[model samples]
Target: MKVKAIRVHKIGGPEVLTWEEVEIGEPSEGEIRIKNKAIGVNYVDIYYRTGLHQEPLPFVPGKEAVGVVSAVGPGVTGIEVGDVVGYADTPMGTYTEEQIIPATLAIPIPPSVDHITAASVLLKGMTTYVLVKQAFKIQAGHTVLVHAAAGGVGSLLCQWANALGATVIGTVSTQEKAIQAAEDGCHHVIIYTEEDFVAQVAEITSRKGVHVVYDAVGKDTFKGSMECLMPRGCMISYGQCSGRPDPVPVSDLASKSLILGRPGMRHYTATRDELLHAAGEVFAGVAAGVLRVRVNHVYPLHEAARAHADLEARRTSGSVVLLPAMPAADS
Candidate 1:
């Protein structure tokens, strides 16, 4: 079968994302060929397109997707043809209508969920899953501050943190986004553009700062996020959407006995077992309604450029996905 995919031929602007027809090959041993229904578009995709997280050029440019298995190769014991599966991985080929995925990375998608939601949660949802469940082990009554409260990671973080009984202080750039963040699970939404987040957190916590700060905004919010934390509190810098934060002086951590971390989904889900474990929690979170995946916008597979443009300009408020093609068959 022929598949249409968005490829980045050169490293530069969104215009570099080109739609091209490619041949779909059979899965090799231990692999499954998937007919992708939904492909996720996230801020990380923008970083790849702009050469921020450098990759070998002229390849497919996405890491998350959900689809039905069209075929399975030998030695793949856990998966079979016709299974609903999804993955978030390093190959960066999920932008295609169909892809050959290693069975190790493919997790069975429960029938309770739809493809769009599955794709939306695969990476970001899993990140939040690991962050709350493993990274800092959020507990009841802990106070947390989440930067970019309406972005992909931020939205998921708010929901998971609140469900874990943490009081969430989410920071957003505008009133509309602040409202959206509150709807997601933020106990308190701070419009960082209009007010000072550090002062707000200080007031909200009655001078006893939060236990942790989930900061993906990086350069713009790092210092402020750190200040919002209590003594020995953790600051998890997982992404650089606002550009990478500058180097910190180690002396800074000494004053607070701070626990600084830079966690990545890749690190959290490095082994197949870890991937399955995290995917299971993510899947259960979605199925149980404890977590919500919001697709704020979707673009045709060929419109990846416009999609990247929208995300980079901060026009998108929640998770975004790319519909590779209309679903042709149900699994």
Candidate 2:
């Protein structure tokens, strides 16, 4: 069937995200068809759009969404028609009304969570889960620093870290974002554009620095992020919204015996059990109110380009979700 979807024929600016018609087949064996209720908009989608994370000449950019099982293929069990499920793993083309995804990738959404809320948190929340739990194992009394603390993943990080009993320090460019970060559980909110973050971190930690620094802003924050860490601390560089970070000398890490990791969801959730555990934790967190997901922006699927532009400009906070522009012809 033909569906109205966003396609990138050439990698460039947000302008390259084209709303066009594409044909997709029904789910084959071990796959299921999803009539998407809400699609997730992430910064990583921008990476794919601009070719910073390269794909083929034409491709779909989004990685996650919450949808209903419209059709179940042969041999697909554990899920059936009418079930509400969410997925953050591959088949990479979610900026559409419907998609066929591997059954294994689908995680059922609890009744307490709405489609928009599930779409908002599935990917970002799971990443936060791994970063805090597996990446460094944040604990009570630990000091944590989060770069872009008001961003999609950043907001979740601050809240989750705080819930883990860490004192959260967040850095943002504007006073507005600082407020948001603080509300999300940052004990200290630094307006990086107006103040020096490294110095502020020193003051916040009494010059001892943080136990872990989550730097997603990439190049601009990378060097300073390392400085914000205490001896033997972990630096989790998961994203590069500013640009790829410059290479580091061995001495930079040797000085403090620092640990650096650049983790991706694919790396942490490669196995079925791992994926379910991570996503399950996020869903449970949301249900129990440990994770307060913020769906601050909602755009119709056709206007994803505008969504991308706002995201790149840092004009958006919390999480963003996309609703289908119109219903499927079959529906």
- Judged by TM-score, which candidate is best? 2
> Which 10-residue span in candidate 1 carries the lowest summed lDDT?
322-331
Give candidate 1's total backbone clashes: 0
TM for every model, in the order presented, reads 0.95, 0.97
Deviation in Å, model 1, residue 259 alpha carbon = 0.8
Per-residue CA lDDT of model 1 for 139-190, tens digit only, reads: 9999999999899889999999999999999998889998899999999999
> Candidates' lDDT values, in order?
0.88, 0.92
- The candidate that achieves the highest lDDT relative to the unseen native structure: 2
- In terms of lDDT, model 1 sits at 0.88
What value of lDDT does candidate 2 attain over all alpha carbons?
Answer: 0.92
**In candidate 2, where is summed lDDT lowest over 10 consecutive residues?**
322-331
For model 2, how does the per-residue alpha-carbon lDDT over 63-133 read when each residue is reduced to its tens digit?
98999999999999899999999999586999998899999999889998999999999999999998999
